[model samples]
Target: MSEHEGTYRTFTGKTYSLYGINTGTNQYYKVIKKLADLFLQQCPDKKRLLFQIQKASVNRSFFKKRSGKNINHSLISFIKKTLRDSLSVYTAGVKHHLRTLPLSQRFDSTLMTKEEQYHLYMLEIELVNRIYKEPFKSSQYKFALLPHCLRDFRPDCHSVPGDVESVCKECTERCFIHLGSLLLKKYNIHPYISVTMDLEKLFKRLKAEHPSIGALGVACVPELVNGMRICINLDIPPVGVPLDANRCARWMKQACESSFNLKMLEALIK
Candidate 1:
């Protein structure tokens, strides 16, 4: 396996690795871009496309009922079918993961069904990125919130509190957080380790401080999509790259080291 395809424990025994989804290539991102294009072709309106995807993610039967006169139900059904077949390989563990989910988190928005949380949310991130990438690039002030799991835990982390969240001290070159921070800073985007749990309050404060702000997120799929939605509602153009797997404590009994596609992050920002 490649460094990006290292074997790691998952919530479900089955792996949901995205490392080689495209067969013989590590660029699973191309698959995502292609699928996003297909979805976009079916629903040209970005906002409505996102809304319909989000709806399908939460409820599998969303496409079954008539949504509205303006909505194209037939095209929406086609998109749903394509997502199931194309995205299933990357979401193999979702069903088993949901079966073992804690009762307390059963109703959590992040713990939606396999199709909703895995397939639809994957498309949602791509769509959100397509819609917000240019605005995020042009904003006068830009910042990024990276998941703490991306930090190299072998050494004592030197991350310290920043104006918004904890900032990486770049103590270890092997850490993905350190590597991602370097690239983000090179593009004039401030990078912070996302330690805060109250995102809504944090975003509200940020909007007041930087009116022309844009936000970028590096998180697992469910959290990343929700964060993008929060930013959009607050008028902060947001872009994000999802972690390769959901190996955090919230998903697993103990947090395991995880990585995101660094190349994908640069692509979204640049």
Candidate 2:
């Protein structure tokens, strides 16, 4: 129902741009913007707002299930109003709302909890599923970028810098990182560890080498969100997988150790 100057249609019949999608319901977008603002402010009433938003979402879900393809302007208007009102709640369930939001759009690292970060990352993973279904099949040039945390940090495990990026020593047998590396090698996918957050630099190198590259990244929620935003800004198509759990020093108060569902990750390869 919308048109943009430079956009491409995906296999799913959805059109998007690395530039951006500028067409969406104004009311819906407005509510989203407002929620993002409140999130940044760390408003105290976030919980109450989240409760209302959740109720509205449930109602919307029910309606869609019962009346698929019967959506009307009035229903949309009602939903928007519900969201707007919910966001007005004072010092409420912000964490609950953050848990449901896709990528803490306005996430403040200073205020965000590890639990909220995990939820936001999960949302990003959900969005990746919707946006880049069967990504490996669609992307000609792809890279597998996994987090360094996935490395086994126990005794005798060691990692060192590589020619292009940090190299996984691949010391631990049967670990998720090892399995992920094997899968990438099997698929002929360029694999790298995101030790540095400067993806623009990495992508610049990738452009020089591959000319055009899409990325299949594995990271925690905050890092995933940060990487995705950078990719979007750079017009790079990326799909992502979140870690199974948060094991970073911030969350665990110790050295980091992370993993993912190898099966889920391999599914993206083919």
Candidate 3:
């Protein structure tokens, strides 16, 4: 892994923080890619493997059902063993976060995701990027949805409505949304500040307009995986970069500053 000093901050997450693994976030990406390559070697079918990983990651009951299969069992065991000491540091707060999660949000499956699921979700993102990167690049119309939380919290965001979501007005040079927007535009990818709650509806409408559409997302792990799944079901090739930490208001009492790996984002699209 590149030991180059990463721009990762020490910001903590209610459930996970990539910086927890090491001062730099590059190791997280490296580890996930290694694990993904190993898993793919066992099941050459990338789509089928992604499905199995996603299913096992979310429902413990479903995971148990597949335990009879050596591949399934080994995949879970391997991920748990391999990630426990490294990437698991990022998810160390998951148990506490789940215990203290408000009763009102108990039904929110994304908020209720366990530590192991977070680890699996990291692999899922890497796998999806590998599967869709080419299609996403060749897509006639490509766009990225950046979480609004990535905006500079120091100033009032000047984002305005766009064709599908809120558009960054470049109000602040230091804002991640602004910086990311600039990088994405270089690759002809439209970047929007994600504010829409009903992604299914929004994606459906967008798909109708751009049949060869591809999507890229920047969000927390669970949310990023969920969005990628939606795009897949809608026949939109998807790739994503998860936030370095889940420090938004949904995870904390108040939204705190958060960021994603800009270098990783460029690597995915470019």
Candidate 4:
């Protein structure tokens, strides 16, 4: 196996101050590859690696010829095995604690297809039943009734930037908790919630036009009132966000209720 060469250059002065083993040369690549394999195993969110299938598949950036004897191009292939390896350790440190949640999370219409919406509704009912009708661990624990927050209404659960399957099971739980609280308080019911109402795959359920499926996968759109802007990027994992002009335009027309027309919004796109 040929060794991979690594180089470094600073195009942007913004260097990540975080520290980790960088596979900056062929020797380190060999060790890094093995370490990365184990690193994936040790990583808490191994399932997240499923999101990196594309990164792994098109992993040829390491093999490109360099100009100098050791290496020519000053800039390193940021996408090489080194970054992925370090990312395993570096990525896992993020911690997200839900400050407040609303009752039954909602989604932008474009990101959500009619089918997914239907499924989630059904799931909500079933899970509520289990919480109320069939007593479970969650109910007896004494969950608080909390007011709706931005994170609660439109949650970027998976934290992936643009993948269609933006909903997270954890976020689903938050939705139910909100609904359960409302039901319990209003109706004096046992507070049961449904479990089944399956979650649909992001790509299959929605038309490819959803902007939430494009730049912001399940992103929390800022609610700007009185000239105050608050944008919260769950800042989870990065994922591929593919977009089409026509699809984007059609999506805005449907989702935003003519409030936004992507085609007409020239500055926004450019």
Candidate 5:
């Protein structure tokens, strides 16, 4: 994956790249590049640069001012052109692009303000999630893939691991246990902790055993995009509910409580 950095051609002769996110440093660029490479590997034949921008810490003026020398004039032009006209027009254009183009070509947020880019990204996620809502609701096997970062980062918040997924032992975080039980008992939605990093394998194995499987992922904006891509590639319809707030240790040091719109979760089941 690291080798995919710095203008590498894909197997299909496409000039794909894992573009840097709001940084001019080589190290940060390389880090985003690796993540983009993993995403591309999951679903090849998608010709576009994966913008590895974190929703919580995105720098809006990344392309506004040149950073040393690694400035991309064309990328700047693309964003400016897309956003220069009318605000409503740009919003509509974003929708059209997301609907028609592949993931990579759908966005070029290099020049947009941080808030604007985050808004566009959220729109894309919302649209994609809604597109899969019906299929997801009808799937035979439904899963609620919860992230470990959503847990309260407490010394006593120990979760028990199982062969398939981790069980949320009623520790410091009651939300996890609450949602897990609610999903299982009421909606018949199996709950899984996403920390094991075996999602692809687990889905593949379960898919082999079951005819159809769908998942409702609870994650931040970036993980939602990655998870949606993988689910689409695997032919598993998925709907996502972004966390109410990004309480991950990286973003918020003190508050580790996991929160989301319970209404949205219930709506998905309904």
Candidate 6:
């Protein structure tokens, strides 16, 4: 990890952006922003959004000294503008303040609360559903729809609902396929999608060009199997071309050794 560059920026810079991954840039961000906006549009009425963001609780020192300018400004401006009229532009792009909004600021790569993480996961699912037009209410179809999402393999549509492990594997396989479908539908060209960053010039120019809401994955490997198995292949340090990202061999092997620390802090003053 660079001592100077914050993890969030590093991660953002390093993160496998969906835009250039496959599909067109416009197609990519539109679908992501559309669903992300859906979750965030109704955010204000419920205190959950604010509380969730607060729960993330980023420290100021974590902000980078230099390059953190864009995202930091973007985030603050988003907060201010969203405060103004979170409801008005909920539908489509209608003078979103993203351009006028500060494009840079500084912050840490903080861990979002379970609620924030849950919303992220929800955004991920919505991304797939929006692109594929999958029925939002049912898991049965999503399980089957998963295979078609990934580009590489298309497992014959067969429902395995009983065994947890089999269901989990199927769910992962299908999600990847669906992601590919999303890109293809959006871009109309066979754009290469990967969990690795390979932007070249596309990554640098796009954010400045348009505004968007960030999301994790539905088509991503960190998928939900039978609505239970949350498989996240957390990586080690030194971001480079992933030889086998999903196969985070060391991370997977030491699963039990690694602790999942969750602290449930309740209101003291309230």
In order, what lDDT does every prediction score?
Answer: 0.78, 0.51, 0.85, 0.23, 0.52, 0.26
**TM-score of each model, in listed order:** 0.87, 0.55, 0.91, 0.16, 0.55, 0.23
- State the TM-score for model 3: 0.91
What RMSD does each model have against the real structure?
3.4, 16.2, 2.7, 23.5, 16.7, 19.6
* Model 2: lDDT of residue 90: 19
Candidate 1 lDDT over residue span 127-233, tens digit each: 89989999999999999999987664445898889888999888877678888899899999999999889999999998999999999998887788889989999
Best by lDDT: 3
- The per-residue C-alpha lDDT of model 6 at residue 210 equals 26
Q: After superposition on all CA atoms, how large is the RMSD of candidate 2?
A: 16.2
lDDT of 3 by residue, 1-270 (tens): 432234346767888988774766777788788878877887888988887777778577865776455446666566666766557777989999888888999999999998888888888899899999999999999999999888736567888898889899887776788889999999999999999899999999999999999999999999999999999999999999999999888788787999888889989988
- Candidate 2 lDDT over 1-270, as tens digits, reads 322212212111011111112232232224344544544254234333333332333334464566444334453345454433542221133355346545644454522433322333333444444455454446678777887766646656566777666666788765566667777778777677767667779877776776566777886545666676566556566767655444554334454555554555566666
Index of the highest-TM-score prediction: 3
Q: In candidate 3, which residue pairs clash?
A: none
lDDT of 6 at 109: 21
Give one clash count per candidate, in the order shown: 0, 13, 0, 15, 0, 17
User: In model 2, what is the error at residue 61, expressed in angstroms?
Assistant: 26
The pairs that clash in candidate 5 are: none
The Cα error of candidate 2 at residue 171, in Å, is 2.1
Stretches off by above 4 angstroms in model 6 are: 1-183, 186-190, 195-202, 207-270
Q: TM-score-based ranking, best first?
A: 3, 1, 2, 5, 6, 4
Q: Over the stretch 101-212, how does candidate 6's per-residue lDDT look in tens digits?
A: 2334212121111222323433443333333231212212111112212223334534234321113223343243333334333422222333323222322232233222
* lDDT agreement of model 1 with the native: 0.78
Ten-residue stretch with the least lDDT total in model 1: 6-15
